[model samples]
Target: MTVRMTSARKAILEELESSKAHLTINQIHERLSGRLPSLNVSTVYRSLDFLSQNGLISISDMGVGTPVYEIMKEETHHHLVCSSCKQVIELENDLVAPFFEQIEKEKKTKVITNHLVVFGICLECKEY
Candidate 1:
């Protein structure tokens, strides 16, 4: 599906692309507010939803109360978020592919979501 790029969507996409860290809706709005005076939280939310639906961006919980958004990359990966320290560790797709394949075989359904977030205590947190 060809998504019509509006000014708001374009700005939001660019912001996500430029940011190395995941951003919440409010963060996206605040960062763009200076450049786009009319940009609102609602618009940012809608644009994020639209982009995510189109597979252009990914939304993950990352153990945070609010979901975070990042621009989709060619190399898909998941996250293991440390509940204690809030450290995020990247999990490669290869490690998850077999698990997803097993689920697909058993459920007879296609897994569409490429990105996943698992919450747990990291080694450091667990040790301490």
Candidate 2:
């Protein structure tokens, strides 16, 4: 299958690649509207959905009200979100590989995910 990379897709990809935090569709639209001037929320949403379906980007529901989007990376990592302060901590996939393996072995099903978001109270939040 062939995919045409539209201007909206290009702008959204750039925004995701440069961002440190996962952004919602609205956030991406808001960030690019000034530059594109004609970009709309529905276009951004469609582009994001297409990219995600093609595995070009990763999407997660970081327990926030909205689903967030990020560019796909070589090293897969998971987020350790502080339930109290909502601080996000990036953790290597290796830390949870064994758990996934165990689940697959016991359940006889393949486990697949680009990223994982786990919630917990951080030390700073706990101390507060």
Candidate 3:
């Protein structure tokens, strides 16, 4: 499917894609408002929803108050989330093959998402 960007929506997307910082919708709108002062909150939200649904971006719950969005790529990785720091570490999905096979057999259902997130305190927090 071809993705066309309207001028304003494109501006919002460009802000999201260009940000090195993982930003919430508020952050996105904050950046865009300086450039496009007329940018509305709902437009930003709708654009994000559209981009996410079309596989143009990956929306991850980084354990922040709000979720963050990143440009979509083929890298299928999981997150090691730290409860103490809210840090999201991306790791390769090199494991879990056996569990997938077993689940599929027992449930007889097609596996949709193999993306698993392991959440706990990191070593630094344990030391404290």
Candidate 4:
């Protein structure tokens, strides 16, 4: 069954669903103003926390100290964070899967790992 959403919640969901990059609360607040002029920071955060708990979306720290959120459309993915620019890039799990499998085999480990995070400077920041 599909759950119905309140206007405030729907507004938040639309912003995330339409975006490609993960967005911090500030970004969301700004984007929402165009349509949801009555939106406030507290409501945005509260609804986000609820949605995250309900599996509607996922939140990750983009190394900017502010939590960024993305639409959870796919399996858990990894990220590349820029130290200088604070840029976030979403990447599929393929890059690190082989190495992780090798490690698990070497250690005779059967651990259930779901999420992986990788941090590094993006190419734009590297050129500086």
| TM-score, one value per model | 0.95, 0.86, 0.77, 0.69
Taking the tens digit of each residue's C-alpha lDDT, what string does model 2 give over 4-70?
7999998898898898569988889999989898998888889999998888888898878899998
Alpha carbon lDDT at 110, candidate 2: 92
Clashes of 3: 0
- lDDT per residue as tens, model 1, 48-96: 9999999999998877799999999999898888999999889999998
Q: Give candidates' CA RMSD values in order.
A: 1.0, 2.0, 2.9, 4.2
Query: What is the C-alpha lDDT profile of model 4 across 53-87, one tens digit per residue?
Result: 76787787667788888877677677776777866
Clashing pairs for predicted structure model 2, backbone only: none
lDDT score at residue 107, model 4, on the 0-100 scale: 97
Q: After superposition, how far is residue 39 of candidate 2 from its true place, in Å?
A: 1.6
Regions more than 4 Å wrong, model 4 = 1-4, 85-89, 95-116, 121-128
- Model 3: per-residue lDDT, tens digit, 29-64? 888888888879988889888877776766777778
Residue-level lDDT for 15 in candidate 3: 71
Candidate with better TM-score, 1 vs 2: 1
Misplaced by over 4 Å in model 3 are 95-117
Reference-based lDDT, residue 7, model 1: 99
